[model samples]
Target: MSKRVHIPEYEQESELMAGEELVGGPAFWFLHLCWWQEDLRALVERFGADPADVDALSDRLTDDDAPWPVFRVPFGGGHTAVVALRNFPDDSGIDYFVHHPEWGRLGHLGQMDGHDTGPGLSWKELTAIAADVPDGAEGLTDPAERFLTLLPMLGDIDTPHDAAAVVARALTQCGIPPEHAPHIAGKILDNSFWELPSWVVRDGSPVPVCGASASPRAIPLAQGITAGQARDLAEALSGERKA
Candidate 1:
């Protein structure tokens, strides 16, 4: 028997408005996954391209340098829906716009306030792109890996259960067997396997400036060291312990 998930009435309404049958949970999750991967890739490429000037690299890593078009969905009539993260100066969220072949760009469909809100684009205006996402693409096949990859992007979620629900839903959407979502979620929570960066608003814009964020499990894996060796890695990274 399939598990009965209880979606809030507001979310149900949003789903209906967005065409639940088309850009449902799977498509939504896939869009976010694409954005997350692209954002990381852009940052790494920038640093790799100019590794000599650390200060210049830091200055260039602002929202202005972020790669756009988190993902695109092509529709009939030569129209395409482009999804991307809202500029930090505007607000921290996701938004989308449609593009016509001859007419140029259309206006935004809607904006979602992080993962707490509804889909930014509607199915009436956008086609399902999740179905076309190749399996194992970007090396994101394992449920645990997917959850960890998405953890940093989930800073808006406060409640533990809510975060777990998001992970479970995304896992199921991304082709993880439905029956295994609960177990995977449990393991993730038990291990506490991810770290989140701290953000601050600078000159009226949110910036991820703190680089000392570390998780108990992540430190060891990051340094390719055993748990015993990483016992003080978090403290050292945070400058809480002397070398």
Candidate 2:
């Protein structure tokens, strides 16, 4: 008698993994964890995928490791669409993920540029903040599964508690250290919406900004603001109390 394969169920679909290759379809974007690139790609390539712009996201992830910056990707066989930059696992040199939510139907944006980075700098506070973050293992939905899918980016929340369940669950899944789980969860919440640095150039060349409309169009439309100015603006928005 042949043994039955065991597959876990998720909110997305009741069906077990259609084998390993078809996992994380709708769950990659709002996923909360920091997954290094090399680990990600190896799993994807093992399943037979050719992704363009794989190195693209790798560059973006290495930088700041903010939320996710977006770039166009042609996956499997389709036109290039935007997906979270540099965060995916790319085994070969191909881009496997795209922004065609309709394909699997998940809402995701491709950048985290303008995250109101500089809030009052107190050495103690910075240290406190820096101390957060769990190990990578606890964030994966399937820890035992070697090829973890960093999918379905987690959404925004009004308070830390709202997102805590999701964060805690992810931490548990990935098996991150308990002491640092809250810290990692906090960063995940902070970076959930992705605020990119405006005025980025295509192919790494600067471009003029006509106006800002959040991404692609958000390259400093009005007079450029200094770092301090940007900080003030963020403070004002965050009400200083929360941020």
Candidate 3:
């Protein structure tokens, strides 16, 4: 009998790669962890699948042809949709795509642009944030959500806890000495988020912006604000709060 596939141990050396090729990477291990923590039957039901098919879908996780673990969402007119993670061409991030036999690939605009479409920074800023992400830190399951969480940090416009999370993630991803990571993260967090440089671009054609209904996670629009101006604003707003 074939051995059952199981979630692998988290390693400090793993890196991002195609989900299908994630075999032993951090993202792959994290995905397994998500599955473990989540209700499989509920997930299958949410995917519009019969609960009995859970085993079959789980089995497909290891199938090469299957690539990403996916589920079929039935649409009107006899069409079935497939939602899966696919590697972006630039290798900056992973994104989900909905595929239909006739309609082709349907992807989020932010996924295509490499940013969170929901009131977030652009791909460039996201990449800069990812650079700080160490190899083995936790909490990143949905790539889009992960990227979204960091958007506020780009503008230095977040609470201390949020700021610390970003710094800690970076420290962890870089494999900083575990003992030192928390200390460094705390120190960095002590700095005001408003003081950080504007890592996000403001001059790109059709610049990304937070809509009126944007989430709290979205960074406030850059509005051509310079780093020094942002620092000044941060100070003005906080009256020497230290961060």
Candidate 4:
């Protein structure tokens, strides 16, 4: 839901230069992510996306607004949405899918390599395209967080391994010690939102850029991972034992 999500062109450029809040006429172009069935619901929910912003995106979706110009994406849940300058790539958007059930709704499904789309497009094609349009998305950012939100959308994943990985990543982003991570992978089902795929569509696929941001923020997985998982990753990566 690129432009469908509602990010202004000018603000899009500014965000890339510096990942700061939108400071323009109305809204900015960027992906809005929701987990599980909470996609659209999260928009107006108490802690959901700002009302002003939702109002802006809603306006665009309901009646084509300027800058946004058009928003033709369809949402299946209340948990995920992407606001940007243009619509998400062809066959690239999603509301719900198989794989994980507890992670929530995965907005970007076809974009992940070797997963989401079910290899409909060759891995070579995905890899090549992703390399050129690494972000596939023109104005999306925070791929890491987006990825965390998509963990529930993944297919062919080993619950233990994937869950452990997600828990570990969430711990780092949340600024918690890796040693304290619970290290549990929520669970997955074709209709489940947990264990989602990457939300940031890289060349129309899900990918994560953990630690890529100067100021890292926790991914939605923070909602699932326990302290034990994180500490495990920390120990494995740093070989440091905290007393």
Candidate 5:
């Protein structure tokens, strides 16, 4: 279960190295949305993998303790895709590589270096997003819970509709019926919600400090505000009015 059965050769390869060019595609995005083993198995099968290999790859990926997990997915006619997970201190992301019989490993996929705009949504922004939820929207009551539910989709959200889709997905994940989830999502976005105060980083952590007179309360960095947002919050806390 720890090693991939589809491509056992990869088990001996060094995990430290990856392709130079990061890549992504429909499969990559689909993989991002998959959190459960069954869904992953389905994805592997769709890529023309053997039934046994499909199960093996899915199990290996879901294993939390698997060291430097990597897998080769068959894409038919001798072409394969190599998927690896890159871990960081604060986050982890997947990278993809194409492998062919004639040519070895190709470009890397899904590299975010120099492309990421840092953290996506701030706590205040998330609060604003959650505030849009209607008074009685089922399973969306707690602001903190709503924020955590929406965290995975934050980077992809650009519009209110995108936010609604994320909410709908979250609702579905919470066991709400698919048909009802969208209806509830629409209702959640129909009204505006109140905003929370911005936060400043004090002692390498986020502290909720709105204005000059407000007392700062230190909170974990997991609160989700970016460094830039923290600086602005600091200025506001210091009573330095922006010109």
Candidate 6:
């Protein structure tokens, strides 16, 4: 299922200085996968190129030393729509656009705010180019839709090693000793969201409990404890007091 998201309103007239750079807009790996899918390939082919030849595309975009515009749109389920734009060398007053599920897009030079509708061109044109790219790719209607469309790609990753450290700290908050908490990963529901196998560790094994946010205010994974999860954690806390 696609996650629902909202775009934060920002000023439309912001601009970037010359020679500024925006890197990794189009989630590099996903761009590679688009090469194998026919529908997705058609979208890129419209620009007279093969998705398999990313180097060629990259080279062309950087030939003129122009700045790239990058954006990250957040969705509710730990997913963000990313895009960047490159300048159109052949065409006058046009730009090349790219997208990644989380990383971002490579879009036209000098169009940072995504609100310019210059002479019959809107920031959404490239999104419309891949509008029918399939596999929920058509969901790139707005910043939010684009984010939800890419949310599913994050569902199959292993827990990042760094989280173990954070989870260790989180355990300490519940009065559990971090040294005894030898940890493992949780299911990859969304790579962008953070959760552990459970904060409850018993007998040198993790007792899978759910619903606690390590940092309720951080990027990639910031959430709150659910009432039920909080209750379970409270029980664990009480157990700590008893012991």
Which predicted model would earn the best lDDT?
5
Tens digits of lDDT, candidate 6, 1-243:
223222222111222222112212222322322332334433333323345556654553345454433334322222323443334354222221222233232221122223322111111221222232233332233432332223222211233456445433433333333343223111112122223222232332222222233221111111143444333323332232112
Which candidate leads in TM-score? 1
**Cα TM-score of candidate 2:** 0.27
> How do all models score by TM-score?
0.29, 0.27, 0.24, 0.28, 0.27, 0.22
Clashes of 2: 39
Q: What is the lDDT of candidate 3?
A: 0.33
- Off by more than 4 A, model 2: 1-108, 111-160, 191-212, 215-243
Clashes of each: 0, 39, 9, 67, 6, 13
| lDDT tens per residue, model 4, 1-243 | 222332231222112121223312112211232221333233223222355775665444323223233212111111122322222333222222211122332222232312223211112212222122122333213433433333333332323344455545543453334443332122222233323222222332122212212111112122233345433322221223233
Whole-model alpha-carbon lDDT for candidate 6: 0.29
Off by over 4 Å in 1: 1-64, 114-177, 180-243
Global Cα lDDT for candidate 1: 0.33
- Worst 10-residue lDDT window for candidate 3 reads 4-13
Worst 10 residues of 2 by lDDT: 7-16
Q: What is the overall TM-score of model 4 with all chains considered together?
A: 0.28
As a whole number from 0 to 100, the lDDT of residue 66 in candidate 4 is 31
lDDT of 5 by residue, 1-243 (tens): 233223333333334332212112223222333332232334433333355544554454444444545433332223333455544434455544333444333422222222322222333444454443333322234443344333422221224446677666655554445665565455444421212234444466432322212111223321344555444433332333254
Off by over 4 Å in 6: 1-56, 60-64, 71-80, 84-139, 142-153, 157-243
Q: Name the regions of candidate 5 deviating beyond 4 angstroms.
A: 5-31, 34-65, 88-91, 112-177, 180-243
Residue clash pairs of candidate 5: 21-108, 22-108, 22-109, 23-108, 23-109, 23-110
